[model samples]
Target: MTGPFGATSTTDDVLAGVTLTGKRILVTGVSAGLGVETARVLAAHGATVVGAARDLDKAKAATEVVRAQAAQGGSLELVALDLANLASVRACADGLVAAGKSFDLVIANAGVMACPKSFTADGFETQFGTNHLGHFVLVNRIAKLFAPGSRLVNLASSGHRFSDVNLDDPNFEHTAYTEFGAYGRSKTANVLFAVEFDRRHKAGGVRATAVHPGGIQTELGRHMTPEVTQAMIESINVANSAGGAPAFAWKTIPQGAATSVWAGVVAAADAVGGRYCEDCHVAEIVDGEGLRGGVRPYALDAENAKALWAKSEEMVAEAF
Candidate 1:
């Protein structure tokens, strides 16, 4: 469905004519890909952007690139954040909170994709720990830093269609681990986090939304081996064939960042909080294996979201 923007829209297009004077934003994973572009466009529009990355040196370099793109009155800075390590997450969040800074928008855009099985320092499966739980803890602890009308944008994925979250065994303590399965569960958790976070905080004028930035060639896919990549493409084609849906194509990096930039800054997005978005609009809810487009029903379920939140709280209690 068409909206103010379309699938080919870029961050600059979504943000055209919008002035972000005095706006304060935090964008994670600014070292490359959509995060860098997202930060760059926002900064160029006159916002103060804090670009978070695991490597300060890299982020400092990246921030220069973003700074170079900034228009008059725009500014960009770098912060260190390593989502996989709870201590790192705590230090980063604490530093910001201690600085008494408030954010108009916080984009949880950093994440890892399907990779060979591994665990975070906290003993969570790497994908679940880093992609979902890491952001979960960071956001919740810094919830107070969100100004009224602030937005939290979680970068979920259409690959969530790979599987529903298995909360009981989210860490794969019992079930066999598959890379994509873990990735899917984590992405689903991103949406569920938005659903529950929005429900709890919307009345206070804070909102959360999850976005599936259309696929683009980025470092996020560095873990994909040739064989795995081929299998993934084949699987998508097979599913599309079965569902009578056209195959999907990769988007340019700018186009890939469009929906996220829209969700974070568009006034219309208030009406779609707790929903999954793509192509700069709220996506439909669909069931089955087809990858054409749409969020899985389970991703937005209130109960599932609530349960996941509770479990997350337990998991991160000590750190928080």
Candidate 2:
């Protein structure tokens, strides 16, 4: 089924005429850009939104932006959540549970990109740890607190096209680390996480979705060097000059976040669990569109997803 909106659709467009009165939503990475915009739209629609960020000050700023844009100036709360640390993830989850609150929507929108090689508190590679495993642990820890009909949206990226999980040496213990490779592997993991989560929790009326928010200028690119940015711009320009690259496109923050918000609230997607989505639609199987926008084969493979889930369970066994 087609998504309720398209790549051009904004968060406001997604929430238009929609009412989220009394619903509780938790959006990570809500400090700026699409995350902030999403929180704004949700609050405007009457959802009680908890905007999670690593920086309390940034979260406060983001909440203020939401309030400024809200028609009713609905509930907006801020809390600290750092996906790089297992203890932090536990603390965040524990705090939420301590509040005696259950969430109808949990948007795992926080992520790191092609950062230099580093390790988390658990000694896992930075990208995989922060972008995938942290959220993995978070969702599992809080699975019990999800209200019926709850939706979990994992903010995946088309960058998964660059690579899949390097299961043999996920942390680069025996091999060299490349920034983009680590980012790609983490992105693939994000999709697999959603697939497996949906498989495990869908029976309880909890649905999971992985979304590629499309390209937008956000603080996400802050880590990119000038050379990297230039190369990216050159690639896009080349693609545009050649008719348009299949893997690359430009979107405003609102447009970029449409797919995520759509996945969260669209009734049509209730039955669309465990799939990769883009442009606010369930992506078509990519065959000829390898150069165009569509999910990569490995990222959407059920077996790979299940395997990754098992591997993640082992990697975080201590936490569980």
How high is each candidate's TM-score?
Answer: 0.95, 0.92
Question: What would the per-residue lDDT of candidate 1 be over residues 1-320, giving only the tens digit for each residue?
Answer: 22479788988888888899799999999998999999999999999998889988877876677889887578898888999999999898899999988999999999999988999998989999999988998898899999999999999998888788887888898999998889899999999999999999999999999999987889999998878777777777787777776776779999999899999897464667889999988998989775658899999999999999888888877433
Query: What C-alpha lDDT, on a 0 to 100 scale, does residue 128 get in candidate 1?
Result: 92
* Alpha-carbon lDDT, every model: 0.89, 0.84
Scored by Cα lDDT, where does model 1 land? 0.89
Instruction: Please list the residue runs of candidate 1 whose C-alpha ends up more than 4 Å from where it truly belongs after superposition.
Output: 1-3, 241-244, 318-320
lDDT of model 2 at position 266: 73
lDDT of 2 by residue, 1-320 (tens): 23357878887777777888889999999888888888988888888999889998867865687887665546788888899998899899889888879999999999988888999999899999999989998888888889988989999987787688988889999977898889889999999899988988999999998999987889898889889877866765564456554445579988998888888887364655888888888876663222346778888788999889878888888433
lDDT accuracy of residue 141 in candidate 2: 85
- Candidate 2: where are CA atoms >4 Å away? 1-4, 71-73, 233-249, 287-291, 318-320
